[model samples]
Target: MTETTIRKPIRKAVFPVAGLGTRFLPATKAIPKEMLPIIDRPLIQYAVDEAREAGIEQLIFVTGRGKTAIVEHFDTAFELEATMSSRGKDLSILAPTRIQPGNLVTVRQQVPMGLGHAIWCARAIVGNEPFAIFLPDELMIGSPGCMKQMVEAYNEVGGNLISVLEVPEEEVSSYGVIKPGAKVSGSLTEVVGLVEKPKREEAPSNLIISGRYILQPEVMRTLEGQEKGAGGEIQLTDAMAKMIGNQAFHAVTFAGRRYDCGSKSGFVEATLELALERSDMAADVRAAIKRLAATFD
Candidate 1:
């Protein structure tokens, strides 16, 4: 039998930024959660940057109320650009961050449904193309972005790819766990099953699902009639599970540091660790850490 070639290119990426960041509280009251700064750049910027690095041409944002700021952030601000240019400052730094004209699109999700619903909001834009979905809250840092790694895996396997990371058994319940199948290659596994937030004892594997996803267009049809799963929300994983028999599903164990920016403590840890890696901040952070440790002693 001849092998079938995957025709669609993963050009478009969907970002579900409509959530009311209740966890962040008062800070998120006016500011959209995606705008919350991880270090100097907003959380959404990192996700967008990751997508662009992964060769995504169109950035589709599924937004809601108070999310206009996110749209504006990616757009060029004439006043700011002019001011910086006049001051002889490096303007190129802002250029890559700005989404190229006509490449960025925003669709509003009126109701706070769920991840699945947010993804479905972009159905019109995604059309029949195999696209990517990124969660800004899952901050992945590496030489090549997590999605790019998954894209490479997709090219090899020619199927739907989800980024998975091996977590301790105790932490498996905190994330969606994937059941292992045949080992396809190094860091790539054929996914037989997926369990969302399963208890440690019931977890099929230690490989917990992270944010990066390269999905087939057919999954949208599954979401169209899919009911809510897990926390009474329309979970994307539920729809993905439906595609098991019909589609080729693979889990790519991403080689990167994933920080769950959705949680307060995780965000702080990411900030500190990322900051420590910077040449400018390394010495200062190290000195401060040493001082703090000495105080505890």
Candidate 2:
């Protein structure tokens, strides 16, 4: 008789792109905010790229009404690609948008629910294994990428791991602050509890939860019974907080840069910053920046 061990290779990642991006206003009225491009690529593309680099095989999208653009973006543009190839255009640029038909999946949320609700809606597809959740609005650009870093940390910790970052104490109230426990060396912090948007003085720690998360299937069950929190919506933090002691919950301070693409100012800044890094756009972007700065000076 041969003994078998369960292999917990993180494979599936869920993207909650269903929310009404009201912050972006008229623009988001038609196109999903996830489709908003940072430079040449869309916000969701950066997130998808990060997930794929972390060895995630299936991309599960939790979409809402009027978000068909997201579905079309991931699907093949056979006619467009064929035309591009015939016109001597490079087809390799379209590689990131290509997800094998079998590898991509989407489930409609059907409502403007909370993040927990959005994640819970995908329960049928997530099954009984550990999975990941990414908020496309939070764009993290780095060498190893945010999710890749979390996936590597997850392989060692084997439980719920959220990518966190340090923010000014005053800004802690705007985020789900982590109630940190024992220092587990390096960037790993044992998560003793969670506080969803606590007052500045009431916050446990300055380390706030960013978008990237590696969660267990049990969370779906927890979310099933979760009530409304901060904004009267089923909060994912509430469900995650419940699993703290029962599961190995920890936080990894992401080694990268994160941009809040959900906001107009942050969106503009990210576009300019990322564009300035590209060789083809750097010179023009820099020149434009100087011209804009001269107006201020």
Candidate 3:
């Protein structure tokens, strides 16, 4: 067999966790939405863990007000660790969760402009490096994690690789839809064009862009112009669309389950599914679910 070489260009990752989770109301009033718990771990933790798994060396978080709790969550809590150690609790449980030293950096978004603006805020820190951007609100559950899969695809293609999934026609209006080009491989499609929040009939394709992306740094220049697109917000997709023919852009259909934790129904579903997957809560959770289902029956 010929040797198959994979090139990994993107090492740093930018996570935009500055969104005001007004949808969650009182719960998110004092807490950042990224800090909301999915099951035992916070939503942002899953995004961080995914980035680390993809061999990302540096983690850049673009945050805003009321997001200090997110910074503290990843930082070393010496007292808490010491207490857990003294209690003879399994430290390994916390090992995979903690952010490795010196690898994390946070930059303030300052303004709630948009996803594009949030990403642009990290331009100085990102410098000239091609990096990954992950939205923690889209909680992905799988053996290899969503972004890791995208990284694997990125190594093969060496250009912008986005995570995409097919949504129902009715749901096309809720996402940035792609105009797909020639097929490259299984679950990998060449991106011809991109449209943000297009109506069902106007959608170029059924494929919807998810939260994971391995983007080239030049896109930063596009956002630097700060031209507003949909909803009068700087749109990353609009910037990315400009890079289409100039660069190699493709979409990877991630092999995993994605939960939109930003929505009420999605959050509840993720919570219940994740809770049921936990050994500590699985049994009781299944029983509770069965009882609840019986009530509906």
Candidate 4:
């Protein structure tokens, strides 16, 4: 089949969890950064739930030496389940943690390379099928979830797709901005080119690449020879840029709230906002927030 051929469905997703999270040093020393919690569920759990909602059957994780906790999080805990069952406690909460046999796969990224290198590590399992990619630290909150929205769009246009959201002009340099082409639809744009962390004056558009992606397997082939780009590491943006005209490349504008849980402020905001939405904690959280605000005043 050719590069643009519609052969297999997008049945798999890759989560790059091998990063040494130096930003959250002390906390992430022992725990994988993806295991950091937002409310009751870990950040990786949120990404997995989003992937499942999008009908993704296989979950592929690119891990590192100290990231075994991530694999354990999705495995069935017999002792914990039995304890809860015998104590007459609710077992429904543990349902999301269980994965069926062979549905989950983990590959180690031996070195701490760029995001492109990390994704390339999972090339074997992804095979020739189109797959989704989720940066677990990005906590996306939406009605149907971010990946579901991308999958719905991917169904209509079956090629490489990336999620984009408009950032302020000054903040454009902090992200990979797209050189947009013709407007495909309401929230879809034809991506003609991609620039990684361009200066504000040189930016093509304020629309920055977000964390969720549904990429064609051809991307893996391009990454095989991908040289270091902006960060002196194998940059995914550079590889994606090369595939712009070869395939049907497009960007889905995510209509949702995205918390960059990789950052401290963003993580705190996500915790408060999600907690405030919960019925069990809303009243207390709001009251505590009011008291905190008074203290600041």
For residues 1-297, could you state the per-residue lDDT of candidate 3 as single tens digits?
322354447789999989899999989999888888887789988888888888888999998888999989877788988999999987787776677788889999887888999999999989888899999999988778888888778777788889999888899998888999977699799999999888888999989999899998998998999689778889898899999999999999988899999999999999998888789989999999899999999
Clashes of 4: 0
TM-score of each: 0.96, 0.96, 0.94, 0.97
Candidate 2, residues 1-297, lDDT tens digits: the string is 311135377899999999899988899999999999888899999999999999999999999889999989988899999899899999999999999879989999987769999999999989998999999999898889998888888877788999999999989978889999976769899999999889998899999999999999999999999998867889898899999999889999998888888889989989999988899989999998999999998
Q: Tell me the tens digit of each residue's lDDT in model 1 across 159-217.
A: 79899998888998888999989776898999999998899999999998899899999
TM-score: model 1 vs. ground truth: 0.96
Ranking by lDDT: 4, 2, 1, 3
Q: Arrange candidates, best TM-score first.
A: 4, 2, 1, 3
TM-score of 4: 0.97
Report backbone clashes per prediction: 0, 0, 0, 0
Instruction: Give the poorly placed runs of model 2, Cα more than 4 Å off.
Output: 1-7
| Clashing residue pairs found in predicted model 1 | none
Q: Which ten residues in a row have the lowest lDDT in candidate 4?
A: 1-10
List where candidate 1 sits over 4 angstroms from the true fold. 1-6
Off by over 4 Å in 4: 1-7
In candidate 4, list every pair of residues with a backbone clash: none
